[model samples]
Target: MSAMNKKRTESTETLKKVLRFIGRYRILLVVSIVLAAASVLLQLYVPILFGNAIDQIIAEQKVNFSQMWRWLRQVLLVVLFSGAASWIMNLINNRIAYRTVQDIRAKAIRHIQKLSLSYLDSHSTGDIISRITADADILSDGLLLGFTQLFSGIVTIIGTLVFMFSRNVVITIMVIVLTPLSFFVAKFISSHSFQMFQRQSSARGQQTALIEEMIGNQKLVQAFGYQDKASERFARINEELRESSQQAVFYSSLTNPSTRFVNNVIYAGVALAGAFLIPGGALTVGGLSVMLAYANQYMKPFNDISSVITELQNALACAARIFALLEEKPESPDPSESLSDVKGSVEIDQVSFRYTPHRPLIENFNLKAEPGRRIALVGPTGCGKTTFINLLMRFYDVNSGTISVDGKPVDQISRHSLRSSYGMVLQDTWIKNGTVRENITIGKPDASEDEIIQAAKMSHSWEFIRRLPDRLDTVITEDSLSQGQKQLLCITRVMLCLPPMLILDEATSSIDTRTEMLIQEAFDRLMQGRTSFIVAHRLSTIRNADEILVMKDGSIIEQGTHDELMKKGGFYHTLYNSQFVNTAE
Candidate 1:
């Protein structure tokens, strides 16, 4: 197929998707259509009233006060009703359009929440946000304008054409001949402009992603003195966006003027034709005037439609992006088997995995932790310590192995139940803009005020919490608290839950050494009678762990207590010595 044909097909599909949302609010849509038709009918008849008043004046050779007065009142009443109907229609359109878009946004967000971690890890945060907010808004605005203009424009064009046919067929024929010229111009420009608008939309998303990334990591950028590099990178993307936007606007902008030019030519033809007919008694002055008015009304709809079409192209492009996100496969279905009466005895058997097919990351890893054991995974960076934890958490499934907790394969258990059995505190903390109590109680919402305070105190977070302006109720803005405070809040959240299993991935990395000791003491109490896996680069933290598994390149090279591993004088010995040696120097 030709490029235009391909675009037309895609546009039709996008339009169908948009109409599905409209179909959801069909009742409001029907009412809006009725109002629009009523407005168009009322407006269409006003020109007839004007023609009658003109003929009465001409026939009397003076102002026919009674006839003209009656015509004036009819025209005024029509104008008033038309304006009221149009206003009501607009109000209904806005309600229906906005409500439908709101529903779409909600559904998209819910789907995003259910998406697998793998999917999220592979996508950019800013792009996903842009699709949900910016692109969705564009679709909403476009639908609103399209619906408002589409019904009225079509009704006006058809109603005016009917009136013109009744008054004079010759002038109507002239109009019929010229109408296609306007449509052709609109179609030609829109076809090319659609691709440009799509490009512009993509560029805008890229720019938004860059801005979100830079702003989110502004501290890092500034700290590293890479502000100029960030600015230059942003400038390049911004320039591309500007060029795409300019091209898209330039082409779509041609639609209105080009259609208007055709309408003007058709109007000139109508005037010329009406002049010859007036002398032959084929047309009265009033009839000629009504025909000209009808001609203007008929052509005006084309201009309105053309503009709507151009805007719709941009909206459809954005809709396509949003729908693409919604179409992603959600998390795998949950199994009927579930963990119950959980005692955290995690066992990894002959596990083999790879992020990519050809390059192996984890190979035949094996381990067993009895209930309530503190198993520390110590390894050099990229030696699969974190990857092992990810497997146990079931964030990524192993290629060939079974990770079981309490004699049940992880895959056999429902993800919700499996994940709820563990309380995790990672090195990177996630704190939302909410009250301090809310952030701490997120893991266990039913936690009472006293319970929340107790958890905070146990995690060494209550000292700072009590000093805040509102204490526990103080809202935590993004920049309101320090990184260590955020990590403390995360740990406090874990303490409140008190799950059967715990995973701490460098949980105290952000805290100062003094606070770390206090938090460590608190964690010592918290880890009692729970299976805990601690992943830490600081070997000092896990020296007293029950069993320290020294990992190297996806396999366990050593497994014993901290002293036993150090006495063996191998990879763990070297790793431990290097850390303390660095500290001593």
Candidate 2:
């Protein structure tokens, strides 16, 4: 296909997709269209009442109040009816358009949740946020404005054409010649504005990302004296948006005036032509008056057409971005078939992964564990410990490896069911603003009060809960609790869920010594029957762990018990004695 044909075909497909997104709203859409048409037809007719009044009195020399009263009544009725129809049109259009936008947002949120780890790794949170929120708003505004104006413009143009041709064909034809010129104006403006508007939208998204980063890390910015740097970048993005938007506005601004200028020149030429007809007894004064009214009204539809065409380009740009997100491939293929009784057993063989294609973080890694085996993974920062747990959870798929639970391939199981088998507590855990009871027992909402308290006690969070004025009903959150308290509650949440397998990724790095010992006791209680993978930086916490794997550069360099590693005189022995053994002495 030729390049232009290819572009048109792609645009047609995009429009088809947008209409598909508006599925099931056909009834409301049809009704809105009909009401809008009725409103426009009535509005167009009401203006013709003046022409009738002038012709009745001026041309026929008849002074009749009944004729005038009749015309006045009809005009009032048309105005009232049009007003009612316009109201109905607006209500129905707003309802359906907003509903469609709401559905888009909800669907995008669900789709993002199902998307694979690689997809999220490729885009930032800010980019996705702008798509679901800002871009959807752009679509809604453009669609409603374009659809309503396009319909109203069409009706007005049709009415104007009928009236003008009925009065005098020669003058009407002279004016109609300028219609093609209006089209040229619209076409020129839309083409010039499309790419500029697209750039502005992109710049807006970048600005959103920068502002979000600033808000999320105000403390870091202050500590590093990076406010000036952050502000400079933000200003640059802001100016980029301003420049693109200004350019798009300037290009489109020509469309209206160019159209109106051509229209005015046509009007002057038509008036002169009509004057010749009037002297030759072909047209009267009333006829000339009526012609001008019809001619002026006819220009309105074309004016609106020009305006709506510009908005159409904007909607098209937003639709392309939205569809791009919708077309992204999600993480894993979720199974429609359900599997039950997922055992906590996990095994990884020959697994390799990297957050990016250029860097390989985990290579040829292998591990094995069954029910009731607690393995402690000890490694320095950035040593693939968290990546290991992420793989087991199937948050990410391995580039070349096999990881499974109960002999079922992780890819073959539904993501929901696969994730339900394990619970997690991380060092930098998030505690939403809610009561203590809500965070725990999140998996099982129907868990009884007794079960909630039991989970809290097992995680050693009960002591802090007892101190709260409301106990389980206390509104617990990071703002309300200390670091130790938040960790305790996070552990309590894991305990409440009672998953067969648990992952603690540096889960106890924040507590003081007194609370740390209590938390360790709680950890032992929580791990009584559950198989656990513990990622810990503090060597003392994993001293009694059943198996300890010492990792370096994503590979296990050594594996043994605490006493066994201390006797090996290897990397573990040197590191342990330097960091922990000497402190103990």
Candidate 3:
């Protein structure tokens, strides 16, 4: 109903999420808390020791040297034990902080893997990475600070109050009267700052996404002479991020000073109260000294806690982003049935789908491929060519109708089995940062040396592979190879598996003509006795395909062999002639 109430509710939810992560290390947390309390209590006892020693040495000549030595020794042991406890507490806190962060990041990655492809297609990769990396790091910092300061501050506050009450009730009451002011100040500032911190985190994610997009496509930006526009866009996002961050920081930063002012007032009250009590014989000089020490210790926790609250607000904001990602609904569960020994018979009956319900991309798409049949899909960009392939692979479920493999619906089979049965090579190549052997053997990890070499040679990638420093063992990255080389490796990966079905999406678009011919020959040999779907933009590439389906705006306009379509003079015929006509120009 109110802003403060809403802020409290959000913070509590975020805190509960954090506590679930922390709850995994319950034993370690308990040990850390015990050590923190022990350390604070020991430190509180030191002030009493100082008061005793001070009272004993009222005069320098009459000072009890033996008595002082004993007290000094006890003080030394207390300090040593307190330092040890604090050090160990810090070590355990570090372990918990880092390990909790590790769990959150790992869970985020695992959840991302389970998410539907549609979700990933709609979201930015850079933003996901920022939440897992940068946001998680901030959470780790907050956890570490909370463990180190929050626990110790609470213990110090409680212990100081107990010690002060045993010495003088009047001074203790005076200190207690001013304590609420610090909490009120912290709560007021934190309430206003929480929303700003949330805004800052979202802006940070946007900036990360923009940077990733620009850097990832730097060549495209430069080639199109759009660098100035890109820079301007980045500047706008950067300015937004700066303004949000500045406001959040400015609001949170007020907590420390405002609370410190209240703490000082409390301290001044203690000093004045103790000073008046000494004249009435209600307190001794040693008692006054102890009261002053307790007052400082009491106020120190409030100051430290106010700062912790500020950090907690920022940390919770980041945690909320990460949690939002984790909360996304995962893909529906697959049936218990698993496809095995796939015969490559695919049937798409009345299949209809769209990214958005308002705009149809594929409607009533129907296709049936018997074993060893090759189906070619040809269309302009955004005509549902790739979307069809995505549906076939079960990347996205159809909005209507059934897609079956070997008489069983795709949804009835495990996704892992359905996907693994098909060998796919797309134009957009992906090469993980690893060795040449690793990349080639990704589809079939246990592939032998001979099998890997044979696949590489078949794909025509062995020519470049043999030239590398370590051949199969050479550590290579995506940037280390040319585009064509990367595509060749992707082709080799599929070639190694030689699955029951195949999908070639402009597989040779990046290779030169000579290499393309060789790879095409290899593909011909590989496609034998295997059902295949090819999405080709170059009309000439699909001339030999068994059945070419011409698609336009989510509908198949024509379907026939190249000669049949050419004789009929349909859309395929026009599209076929247009390519040669453009080349002639």
RMSD of each: 1.8, 2.6, 1.3
In order, candidate lDDTs are 0.91, 0.80, 0.92
* Per-residue lDDT of model 1, residues 1-585, tens digit only: 998789788888988987897799899889998999999999999989999988887645577779988998999999999999999999999998899789889989999988877789888889899988988899988989998998999999988888888888878988998899999999889888888888888988888899999998988999999999999999999999999999999999999999999999999999999999999999989888998889999999999999999999999999988888888999777898889989999999999998878988899999999999999998888999998888888888889989999999999999889998999999988998999988888879888999998998899999899999999999988688998999999999999999999999999999999999999998999899999999999999998799999888889989999889888999899998998899999
Can you tell me which runs of candidate 1 are displaced by over 4 Å? 1-4
Give the CA lDDT, 0 to 100, for residue 321 in model 3. Answer: 95
Query: In model 3, what is the error at residue 336, expressed in angstroms?
Result: 3.5
Clashing residue pairs in candidate 3, if any?
none
**lDDT (tens digit, per residue) of candidate 3 on 1-585:** 888788789889999999999999999999999999999999999989888877787675888778777878889999999999999999999999999999999999999989999899999998998999999998999889999999999999999999999998878887888899899989889888879988899999999999999999989999999999999989998999999999999989999999998888888888888888889999888888899999999998888888888898899999999999999999999788888888999999999999998998899989999989899999888999999999999999999999999999999999989999999999999999999999999879999999999999999999999999999999998789999999999999999999999999999999999999988899999999999999999988888889999999999999989999999998888888999999999
By lDDT, the best candidate is 3
RMSD, candidate 2, Å: 2.6
* Best of the two (1, 2) by TM-score: 1
Order of candidate numbers by lDDT, starting with the best: 3, 1, 2
**Per-residue CA lDDT of candidate 2, range 504-580, in tens?**
88888877788778778877877877789999877878888888999889889999888998888888777776676
lDDT of 1: 0.91
Largest TM-score belongs to which candidate?
Answer: 3
